[model samples]
Target chain A: MTETLSIETWRLAASYLFLVLLMIMSQLLKLGHGKEFLMATVRMTLQLVLAGYVLELVFSQQHLLVTLAIMLFMQIFALITIFGRVKGKIGIGLKKVVALALFVGTSIPLAYFMIVVISAEPFYAPRYFIPIAGMTVGNSMTGITLGAERLARVFQTNRARIEEALMLGATPQEAVREFLSDTFSAAIIPTINAMLGMGIIFIPGMMSGQILAGASPLDAIKYQIVIMMGILGSVVFAVYLIIQLGYRTFFNERAQLLGNED
Target chain B: MQNAFSLRNVTYRTILSIPSLDVATGSVFGITGKSGSGKTTLLKLLNNLITSDTGTVNYFGTDVLKIDPVTLRRKVMMVPQAPYIFPGTILENIQLIFNFNRKELPVQVEIESLLELFDMPGMLNKKTANMSGGEKQRLALARVLLLDPETLLLDEPTAALDDENARAVFEYLAWWVGKSGKAVVMISHSEALISEFGGSILALSGGQINSFNEEGSVHD
Candidate 1:
């Protein structure tokens, strides 16, 4: 039974293999070096195999502290990724603050919904908390990165337009409102598309996993709905926070535009 | 009319330090320089795109830096050098700057008048991406002009045009200058064109306004 490749595992493995192969193929074509591809394949196999074992331990132990620790680490990693991607300087140290904001902003409501709202057992179950947190933080990370980057780029490129808007008697919000609108909508489209495709074109990994573990279709569907809502919430919160913070950072209290200083 | 745009010691860095210039009310001020001389940067500063590090930009009596951005944009609109024809029809691109319906807000008159201004009345509903360089420049100018800005900051408004099209654009701008009495600041390297228009010329070099010629000289 364990050796057999079920529909779920087969789909998962094939998708992962396809991505790894594509990356390898692109690199190979560029450098004519098969060594990197070989190394990457080996690394993927080992990492996934080890991660599977670690997940088994995590699932069995279900210790709240360990789960919380893992969640925090993922959040920190995501924050750093966002900082590097948006601000273009990894050492800017904005990640810690952003991490705190993301955690407090996303996790508390997620925890409440998972615990008090859904009433899932052990409250901090790695199976529930870790994956859900991962989904939420992952989406928020993308939104914040996109928002920050868009804000910086628009400000840099469209200075005349922005300033012209300002001089035309638009408030800071009024001046940048259209640009922000386009950017925010762009940042949220992925999450929106995921929601649109949920269970129709693609069965999410979590839902499929629950089904594989013997949960009924209805039960899996319920979890999927809850998680999807959480992801949407996270995206919305992140976008709002980043825009608010970005506006404050981009302009002064007297409505003067600020330069992109290090 | 009041002096609509003013800059006091307006120093900015974009590859070099840009010098300050004051534009009088109701006149065309031409920003002339060779390539890479920061004409675009000065336009951006006057338009309030980038804040000066150590000076104040005043619009009328109010400090432009302190003014709201949206208000600033409405007052001083810039038609960029390379027109960004957005992903729609010519009408849609113009409609992007406002919140009202295209049909409700004198779309045909605005479109017709602008097209008539540029003498391209037949190209109203055309897709902007497929349009040629001269067409795009005309469309971009039309869109900005529809906003009715007090200060028009045009970057290479005729760079892409042929002799005829360039002449048409200049004629349209000259007519508008005569009618509205709004400040028109343009960046042009064309000496012959500057001589023809005969506006005050501000020469930019190493980011500074090196010379100001009110008589519109052939050489800086």
Candidate 2:
């Protein structure tokens, strides 16, 4: 195997030239975003370096508890991001569904991938488990956020139509059927488009990273394919769970639509 | 048991309160008050769209809380003040209601006759998207009326109608009630229309019963 060359400190520092160029251009144009750009770059460096140290420690420990803790941490972080990033207010009921979908939707697929697809012996091996779980959870987080937001928006807009159906003796499920289908479609479209554009439109960041890390091109491509499939499965499952369970939150046990959705 | 709806100590969110009210079967029960009188809230309670905060609302002999909401709505349907017109032809709007209840659609001739009753003739294929407010109101009425629910609930069923058309519509409702042996609970702001056709008129003031006229006559 050909070992990839490592960048030295000075060489790594040279990468800041790109940011400096961007800031100079912004200044010349009077864009006023130079501070934001600089702050963002500094924050990214700190976050990635922190993640690197943590991963390095976990890799050395190789304990089941440590790996599981990391997995849980990733999941909670994803859940928080989903809740925070959604555009409008998410009702308490729908918020619970989002958390449930994110946890179960990603975990089940990840377990299956670890057991059957990759067949990791310990299954909680940090090196294999953490990256894969991160990918799965991250992709599903986006899908769930999109699904939750769209579901809330569509329900708010189509409320009168839904109520009219309910008055006509339609079940709550029947009333929101079309809206759920539409929300599911809207949520998953980004993932589908990414899939369509995978090889031709852009080589994925993971595959590029793997190749840069001295893995064979063929090996990198194989990992990319499996990871992409894992992502798609996770996203579809999470979004499906969200739309199905999330809509029920809008209604009561008696099938009466509750007060206004947040 | 002869009453279609029996309400006792019903109150809903400062919108409606009825200490004791009975809507008789086989008659047109008119409810009237100015806006914010909780007229629509009463209809919602009857249809199970909302449960009263405090009080029991019974349908026929059964407490509505014990019944499934979907089944309750099918048996007692409502048409709101500004009815929603689906994005389709008039025939589709009618068919969609039957679809909701999992009942078979009526014959096209039946739908045509209903439209004719509402002063809309030969308009089954016309798109509902372009319909006028009054036409949409009538189309909504035609849709629910075709379903043949045991009790019909209306929220200002003729606010969009002219007096002549409103009177004609009320006459048809009175005739339908007499013919079918079912009941109707309608909310209207116009006292003259209620006085002319309503069998038992109810007037609400600030969500409480201000007057109850059993002879269907409005009190001066």
Candidate 3:
């Protein structure tokens, strides 16, 4: 395998020229986002540099406990981001349900991919585990957030039909089944579209990263395929779990459709 | 006869507060009040759609909270003011009850008779999306009638219909209660219709009972 060329610190600092050009272009166009763009660039650089150092420490330590702790931290961060993305006030009970769904949905496939699919040495190796977990959990976080928001919105809008069904002796499950299915479909469509456009429309970031790291194209393609499949599985599972459980929150113990007070 | 619904000191969200009320079987109970006087909220309470913040609501002496909501709703159905029309043909909407309960569909002859009774014979095959407001109201009534609940809590069932159609709906409902001996608690703004059909009336003002009348005789 050919060794990948490394960029020196001075040469790497040259990448800031692109941001300067972007700021200048924003100014020329009167877009008024020049300050925001500069701030974002600074934030991104700082965050990535901090992440690099933290990852280096975690990678060198290579302890199972450290790896699991990082995974837990990522899951918590993902859950918070998801809660932030969802519109309207979601109950703490519902938030717990979503967190649990996200956890189980991400962990199961992650374990399967690491243990059975790739069979990585020291199964909890930070290098393999962190990236795989990140990809799956990150994708599924977006999926569940979209699903929860859509479910809440649709349930509120179509409340009359749902209540009509309930009055006709339909259980809460039977009443909202169609809406739940629609939410799942909406949540997964983006991921499905991304999969469809892979390789032809654009090479995925993971695959490009693998190729840049001096791995053979075929080897990179194999890893990409497995990770993508893992991501798809995790997203579908998370969205399904969230919708199935989340829908019940919209009804009461007496099977009546609860109003969307929030 | 045992009252179909009984409430005592029932309160909800400061918009509804009933000290005591009873609706008996084989009787037409009329509810009258201005908009937002909790007219609809009273009907919702009968079916356990919304529980009271305080006090008790009972269906036939049994606490509504204790009964299985699905079973209670099947027995005591509420037809809202602006009823929802499911996406489908009129026939499908009418037949939705059977589908929901996993029962055999009603016979064609029975459906035809019901359609004829509701003055909707021409709408059996028409899509519900194509129905007018009044037609949707009738369709909603037809759909609920298919379930054959013992007590119907109707909120402005004829609000969208013309006088002729409204009278026709009331006439059918009068016949329905007489024949089946089922109870009805109806909220309406038409004082004439209420006086004509209501066996008893409960007038509300700002969520509190203003007066109780039997056979159109006001008694505070």
Candidate 4:
């Protein structure tokens, strides 16, 4: 296969013009986003550059333990992002539950994709492992965060309804079943919408990146299809696990609903 | 008559601190207090909705904390001040009790009878979301009555009703309690209603019982 030509440093730096354009537009419209835009651009560039160097070293080394360690780091970062994004106070136990859900949700599908589907030769090839894991973990993180937030909000706002169900002899599980179903559906909607619009409205980032890196369009499409399926599976699994396990935190062993103190 | 509920030194945070109280079947126990005096909190303790930091609440003879909360709650239902109507028709909301218990739903005639009893015969097919405050309260009552609880912990069940409707609700509750021999512990601000309907009254102040009047008179 022919190697893809790399962009010169000057050409890469030219991308800053887009950020400058955005800042100009923000200034003209008085949108108050000019500073935010500038700061975001700086952060993105610095983070990506550092990440590129780290990836280069990991790829060259091809050490299985190193690859696994990086994967663990990515999972931790994703979990932290989810915890940070949650709006209200969450119990420490619930936070651990969230992390466990993400781990199980992303790791299972990722293992299947790497071992059974792609059948990576060395099994932990960073080139194949990191990107796929990144996509799966990132998407599942968002899904679980949305699911958790929706669950908390629904429980808080509809306390009377939940208690009414409880009063009528419903268990905590039975009482919040509808809300859990709704949260799962709401969490996965963005992924469903993206699937609906893919190829027609816009090319997904992973597929486009693959194509730009000199992979055949057909090969890129195959990878994209499997990765998207893996992501969808992970998100569904993560959200379901979260709603199922996370709900128990809201109630005690006697099935009494825990107040705000928890 | 059996003692329906007995509280001893039940303190729930700073919201409530009842030293001792007993509610018996075949009676209506009125709990009167200013807002934030923990009237609702006391009821929640009886149903095991909230555990007290101190003391025991006994349902029948069993400590409420020792009993299965779901089982205890089924026998001691609570109707909050602002009742929540589940997302469904009035008929569906009434049938929800069976759904929760996993029992066979009552016949259409029984549902219709309940609606009639609640003075909401025309609302059988009406959506709960469209119900007025008074209608929702009656619907909530009808729903709980179908459960046939031994005790009803009502937080101002008729607070949203007009004078006539409120009177009708109390009368129905009185008749129902008399027929079933079930106890009702209700929170109410209306002195006249308390005097007329309350078999015994407990007035709360600053999270403690200020007065206990068996005659149901205004305690000053």
Candidate 5:
């Protein structure tokens, strides 16, 4: 047989092409809804290609300021994604509160671990800081979005029940007390289940990448454990803050559910 | 025993600009009209679930609009036409509004007392989600009554019950009204219950309370 490219290079190239083909097929088949999928593909390609060029520059310069700026930009972009998904389903004013809560609750602890615990010096080491921040912010964004969307939908659907409770002397929070657990559980379950399936079903991305980068399997596994714990922590903190923020939306001076938008 | 609640020029409209009406205290306050007459909207006004564009709601001769809404809520409660049961034990379902009630009436005591009063003592530990339609109605009644608001605004409390269950539910309510002496404002199409209650009945039509009937042949 004729000699061909090595297996790893061929695998990477084929997979990348297939990913594009899948995006095109999704649009062609009309199986997936919304123009967002096509838009998302375009966004992913453009952003990642731009990110690669920037990272090449970043790696060479390795300036702490550059790393910090990238981390800040990632956090802001994650916040906006969360805001966009949630605001479509709930109050738009809630977006600012959710974004702030997501950043403060998640980023604080994540930055702490990155600097104080991991103790990576120059403090803003792009390789360590950027990926970890991306992972933390990305997962927290999902958790917050799910939490906010579930809460808003529950209130909108069960508003009559809420009003009935108020009529019966329940505070707005107390009225929604039954629903809080439901929302919290809904928000966190996906992460928990993924954690459950992480090892037996499939290796997570970070650990797999670490192994491919020639780290010992055990070292990669330990890193995965630490990252998973960080993710769980970030998800929990973000969801809790959003719930607390979402509850306050229901009341005004008169203790009524602020007028339903639709 | 006393004129329990009052409303003066209590006007409510959707964002779509519907007109408002007023209601007085201690009226049997029959909110009856065609389906889209905003009967529920007007009932929501008394309960303060819906706010009006103009005018004030005065309960106990105090402008309800000015009072703390939480405080006002304790005074004015509603039993929706179709009862909704929270996902909990029957005792918890009944005590839905009492989440902050410090006394926390012993669950057994509250359930036993409410059930015996409403003739449903057997449903104490049952999950509210599984309750039958009649049971849900009784559970809802027990819930609102536990809070003991001065004005009870009921919207079709027995709408879905069988004739026997419906009669039983209304009888329980009528007996409770007599015993509690609170103003019972029920929105029902049941003329038999309306005439039997024998308080002032105001017929609502086209978003206005136009008929005040003292005595009329009552039919279901």
Candidate 6:
């Protein structure tokens, strides 16, 4: 059993040399990404450093209120990010549905994973909760954004086909049925592809992080598998919720298609 | 004779402002107007597709807003101009629309006969993707006809047809409505076509009805 090797502050600074090399090469090639490279390097360093300090405090406290509050913050931040990330303005109705889906969708799987699967001591264990919450919430954010964007695009492009169905006595749900299926598939593909390519395509970040932190490879792989399942569950459920509820936003109370679907 | 739809003070944005109008059942209630004269909007209001900003629209004496929109639309089907021809065979398009409404599939013979009336005999298995503009319009009409709705709203139902084909379609529509005592509210750009077959014509100008044959339905 070998002890995990820790990088001291001075040694960690050496990583920046690789970024500098990339930025210099880009500048030499006139690829026009040198500034972007430099900014990304600085941003990553500052963000990770702040996150590490905050996580240390959160882990030490282990207070239920503190744990829940941080999760809530993560959820809200993810909600705002989805709004910003989606291409179209998600009308207020869909906005509410997205908010509800993110909260409920992420929380259900998270509660089950923490309380039942890991059975973390006292159930609010920050070490177990925060990382898992971050992964599930982050993945769900991506899924919801994709789902929302696809839903909006369909309404725009397929307006005539949808209205025709409506004219043939189709319900709003019936009119958008094919598009919803398309949206759901489009949203979940990235998550599904990652699952297919796991380990073969690349070692996942979580598994690598655990191995570096001195966890056994067997234990790390097990955690990765469960966390991956948790992420898939969150993304699928969140996307499903958004697809089902978000589309109704394009229709009024009488199930008539709204002309202003921006 | 029963009025299929009656309107009073129905205003929808700047597009329509019909003070009063009545469409009697059991005849072709033809509507004529230039494009953007609120002809289509009037049809939409009849089936409760769009709510009027003011005034009540009554469907067979029931205030349209009170009826469930899906139920109302099922009974009063409205086919738009340039109707969508779905990406499959004519049969598939018909089957899909029936599927959407949860209606039972009509017999193969029944479907073939309807297409025959629209001059699309032997088109059941023909791919809709290759249908001409006129054929697609007829296909859309035949699809709705299969539903056998209580009322039909058609926007420019014969706009793409040659006179011969258009005459055949109009003749069938007259027969179809006469046989069942059903009603039709059709918007036609051609005044002559609508005037001849249209039992009680309502002409719209700038979103207002300039003329309506209030007593013509019973005579027709």
Report, for every candidate in turn, its global Cα lDDT versus the true structure: 0.72, 0.88, 0.85, 0.85, 0.73, 0.87
**Per-residue CA lDDT of candidate 1, range B92-206, in tens?**
7666655421223355876787777776777767787798878887877877777776778888988988888787777667667768888888888665675576567788887
Candidate 2: fraction of native contacts reproduced: 0.83
Off by over 4 Å in 5: A1-49, A60-65, A83-87, A260-262, B1-3, B14-27, B95-97, B106-114, B127-130, B161-181, B213-220
User: Sorted on DockQ, highest at the top, how do the candidates line up?
Assistant: 2, 6, 3, 4, 5, 1
User: What TM-score does each model's chain B reach against the true chain B?
Assistant: 0.88, 0.95, 0.94, 0.93, 0.82, 0.94
Tell me the deviation in Å of residue A99 in model 4: 1.7
lDDT per residue for candidate 5 within A68-99, as digits (tens), equals 78878988888778766665677765676687
Model 5 TM-score (2 dp): 0.81
**A53 Cα displacement, candidate 2 (Å):** 2.4
Per-residue CA lDDT of candidate 2, range A210-247, in tens?
88889988999899999989999999999999999999
Arrange candidates, best lDDT first.
2, 6, 4, 3, 5, 1
Candidate 4 structure, TM-score to reference: 0.91
Q: Which residues of candidate 2, in runs, are more than 4 Å off?
A: A26-29, A260-262, B216-218
Worst 10 residues of 1 chain A by lDDT: A89-98
Q: Please give the DockQ score of every candidate, comma-separated.
A: 0.18, 0.62, 0.55, 0.52, 0.45, 0.61
Q: TM per model?
A: 0.69, 0.95, 0.94, 0.91, 0.81, 0.95
Between the candidate structures 2 and 5, which one is better when assessed by DockQ? 2
Per-residue lDDT of candidate 6, residues A6-119 (tens digit): 899888888678988898899889999888888988899899999999999989887999999999999999998888886365677888999999999999999999999889
Clashing pairs in 5: B81-B155
Candidate 4 CAPRI level: medium
Against the true structure, whose lDDT is highest? 2
Winner of 3 and 5 under TM-score: 3
Over the stretch A1-262, how does candidate 1's per-residue lDDT look in tens digits? Answer: 1333356776767767765676778786775656666688779889879978988889999788899898889888887788766565322333443555577767766777778756768888787787788888898888777766676777778876665445434567766787888878887888999999988999999989887777888988988899888888888877777666665566765565775331
